[model samples]
Target: MVQAEPETAACMALRDELLGPLRKQTLSTEKLCEVGRLFCGAPERMSLYGVAAPHMEAGGVRVRGRTAVECTIDEYAGEAADAVALYAGNLREGSESDPLVVDLFCGSGNLGHHLGRRLGRRVHASELDPQVYETARDNLSRVGSGVEVEHTDYRHLIARLGARTENDVYVVEPPWGDAVGAVGLDLTRTTPPVADILADILRARAGKSCVVVTKTTTETVCDSLRNAFRGAAHLCSFAPSAPGAGVEFHIFRLGATDQP
Candidate 1:
């Protein structure tokens, strides 16, 4: 008989607890953070085995209706994906000597954090939620000491970036309420649709080789952007093929025609 590894005890204990019929009825982003912190502190041996942990303490957990879900550090919509996609494509296309890139609605500064590391430049982020904004500030501070995070609505982010136009690269991950209110989203009345926000950013850019990325479930965002930018758009679309999920994920890219 093979001997059990030293970590087997803790790993099995964790597996049993996590696998037991989901008893965490009080779910919120704060609660998620607490759990994440606890889990992260578990013995390194346990963590290395199979008890997966978040990269950053979970900002929070989200609860809606009767179902509850945990929010990982990078779980926010287009948060990680947008930054990574842009870094590989448009963000890399421009040299570090170019203008700064702004990440509007920069929750936890994930997009900006990744952009700064990739391009070796500053990434300005705008966020509104006090808790989330603070979290982003801390994260970005470490990634790029030059990162500037403003705790304000994304609508005002452009003005701030416009003032710092040495190298203008814009990346955004607007909130589209998934089942979880991870982004402090008010799902009541969809006041400014994602498309409108994209249009607003496009206008505010004022002709710079900007790279804008957004996450959405409908083709409407692409259509709207195309109409507004006149066929100057690159769109990548993907849909989860799991059961009972009909919505798709769309990555829309609109580059600046003229570099200022």
Candidate 2:
């Protein structure tokens, strides 16, 4: 039998190490395949995900992916950012300068970093988890100035900011369920239920301000939004990339009822 080269052996070992725990989870075959690709890259990139090499990439920009799972944001975060920018523009009519963008739950700072660069706006981002917050700080640091990533809860951060302007936009992508592979049709099951924050979000929104939430598809989310906010609300579906992916985002919009 032929022996594997040192580099090939290292890659395989690292892949096994990263995929070991993931395999034990309820991840679908498609998710497993995606995770497997993290190890097939340049040995350096593989090290970034496997070992302590600090780096991340999303939308063609380098980020800090502390773990293999962190790299998955690269697949869909860009599209989500695009949706944000479109809604922001629609919310505020003829704003000469970029709006104040706040990401309530900035995982890895992917959406916040993308918006900061794309819109040239001052972005305020927060993450509750300290370890993930460190990764987010590192990732946003590489982007440029005007982006702030804080290791703080979203509610506290919002409170500190106080009253917002018509040019303020808030973005939230909360954990849908308890576990990584958990699935459900109820938005309340999400960590920090959307209902808990809806009133505060509505009060924080200026006349032209907008709130964008990316959530797992649920039949009740739309009605919930409408009942909470008297302003215009729109919910659009994002199809999953794979047939059995089991993850789809419903981008919910509130505020700016008059925008065409």
Candidate 3:
């Protein structure tokens, strides 16, 4: 007597046929490590999976303005990971309704892939580096949304988002390449600051509610950002628990304003 939703039916079928089995089957890191060692003829191959293998495997050295520091695997930050988890939690309420999620500075597309698979929505990712962009494109393909990747900088993200008005939720991880005022004359040991990118997004679309996650630990930079963004900024530190995880990251929820 009751009409069933088309999306719901399709999702149930997908779960029964695909994901249910995957969930039941556990991936053994130890086995993967053994295989990696056997394939590479090096026992250390397994340890390489931490935060350096992907870039090393690509044979890419640091280039452009990103070379002053040593390169680490562009692994997804824990806060960004947490944000995705929370977003997934919200989706459990309604099976059929999936929000359009956009991820900027999507290095290797790991975060986007997780989001796309979990929420069953079209995922869009943008990256700056050609090498990294290709990597993201390849990684996202594993999740079923093909050719949805774009190679671009975060500065032009507003224009891209305008064209895709369907994208209501934004998951951004802009490049924290330099510390505040560290471009030309001023320089600091700060790894990556998330304020400039936040300001740009705020200036572009102040009315839209965006969930932004940034990874950085420069005190001066943090102070500057907190002073600049005011109530929208919140420090999300995971050090006490996840010791080897990452630096203290910032989470900002942009406030609604009449300005566009």
Ranking by TM-score: 2, 3, 1
lDDT of 3 by residue, 1-260 (tens): 00012224443443333223432232244432332233222323322213232233343321111210111122333335555556423443234434446676665455555555555566666777776666446544543442267888766865546422222445555444333232211112222234455556656664554555444433344355465457573434332132232234455555552336
RMSD of 1: 10.7
* Candidate 2 Cα outliers beyond 4 Å, as residue runs: 1-72, 90-98, 143-146, 179-185, 205-209, 217-232, 240-245, 255-260
Candidate 1 vs candidate 3: which has greater lDDT? 1
Compose the digit string of candidate 1's lDDT tens values, residues 61-148. 2222111111212223223344445443544435554555677766545445555656666667777766556655664554334458
**For residues 148-252, what per-residue lDDT tens digits would candidate 2 score against the true structure?**
888898887777775445546676666543423212345555667766665566665433445564545424444543453344466566643533333455455
Supply every candidate's count of residue pairs whose N, Cα or C atoms clash at under 3 angstroms: 9, 1, 1
Best by TM-score: 2
* Candidate number with the higher TM-score (2 or 3): 2
Give the CA lDDT, 0 to 100, for residue 188 in model 2: 58
Candidate number achieving the greatest lDDT relative to the actual structure: 2
Local error of candidate 3 at 7, Å? 49
Q: Identify the runs in model 3 with alpha carbons over 4 angstroms from their true place.
A: 1-79, 87-98, 142-147, 163-167, 178-193, 218-222, 233-241, 257-260
- Global lDDT of model 3: 0.42
